[model samples]
Target: MVKLRLKRYGRKGQVTYRIVAMNNLSRRDGKAIEELGFYNPRTNESSLNVANIKRRIEQGAQPTNTVRYILAKANVL
Candidate 1:
């Protein structure tokens, strides 16, 4: 199964996330099939590849809960 989820990055206490399409069994921060966007919690900033995200979702990628909220906030859901 493929899932749309966050990939952790950056240093301690200042972590950032990349919204990526990855296999369900893959470890967090493992290889991604594609990087769809990013989120910076410290700044509450996000950037998305809307078209690609839609496509992936249409193709059966399930977004995690946090990603779903972010997408809703962006009005992309």
Candidate 2:
């Protein structure tokens, strides 16, 4: 199953996340099928590819709880 999730990156205490489309069984930081957006918790900032996100969701990609919140906050869901 394909899932829309976050992949952690950046330095130890300054971590950021890349929103990604990846296989459900993969590790949290594993390779992804596609990168969909970005998020920074420290600043509550996010940038998304709206078109691709809608496309993937329509094709059966399920977003995780956190991603769902972000999408809703961005008025994309």
User: Cα miss at 64, model 2 (Å)?
Assistant: 0.4
Q: How many backbone clashes does candidate 1 have?
A: 0
Alpha-carbon local distance difference test for all models: 0.98, 0.98
What is the alpha-carbon lDDT for the whole of candidate 2?
0.98
Candidate 2 positional error at 70, Å: 0.4
Query: Residue-wise lDDT of candidate 1 within 1-77, one digit each (tens)?
Result: 99999999999999999999999999998999999999999999999999999999999999999999999999999
Clashes of each: 0, 0
1-77: candidate 2 lDDT, tens digit per residue: 99999999999999999999999999999989999999999999999999999999999999999999999999999
Worst 10 residues of 1 by lDDT: 68-77
